[model samples]
Target: MVRATMMSKQQIAELVEIARRDHTLWAALKDRELDQFNQDGSVKIPSISILVEDFVKERCGASHNYAIGSLIVALRLPIRQELGLPA
Candidate 1:
């Protein structure tokens, strides 16, 4: 099996661009059900994150890997910037 490696900033940027253009994928990412909530009302995506990671990897022809924290940071920073929020 081909093990995955960390996705570079460029790769993550490309994935973000693709997600923006694809309505279905964008929706999936936005779906509340895909997120796991903790008892304190925070996300606990031990499994959910993996699912999203795998989904993105597959979409990008399995080129690179997105660790849980890296994926969250990569995706959130852009949205935060777009919303005029501090990143």
Candidate 2:
């Protein structure tokens, strides 16, 4: 199951902005090969590694919490656009 982290909305926004501009960052976030799920079949978000944490922090001065929320927000963009939903 994915761990939960507390983050400010502004931090999430900043991380999203950074991911949008950096393809490497974008790829890291978009990739979900390591995802786990709960007994209810809901996705269980995995924790971020130190390396990924550092990379994101380096770009947006955000912490793991920010990355957690930003990842959700970031991942949704492509899906939303693909489905013709507002992004």
* Every candidate's CA RMSD: 4.9, 7.4
Model 2 scores worst on lDDT over the 10 consecutive residues at 27-36
Error of 1 at 77 (Å): 3.0
Top candidate by TM-score: 1
Per-residue lDDT of candidate 1, residues 1-87 (tens digit): 755567777867777787667776455554433345767997755443565577676775566544545665676665556556677
Clashing pairs in 2: 2-45
The per-residue C-alpha lDDT of model 2 at residue 37 equals: 51
Runs with alpha carbons beyond 4 Å of true place in candidate 2: 1-5, 28-70, 78-87
Task: State, as a TM-score between 0 and 1, how close model 2 is to the true structure.
Answer: 0.41
- TM-scores of the models, in the order given: 0.51, 0.41
Q: Write model 2 residue lDDT over 1-87, tens digit each, in one string.
A: 556565677766666666567786455544442333557987545433443466656764663334354556555576356456678
Error of 1 at 8 (Å): 1.1
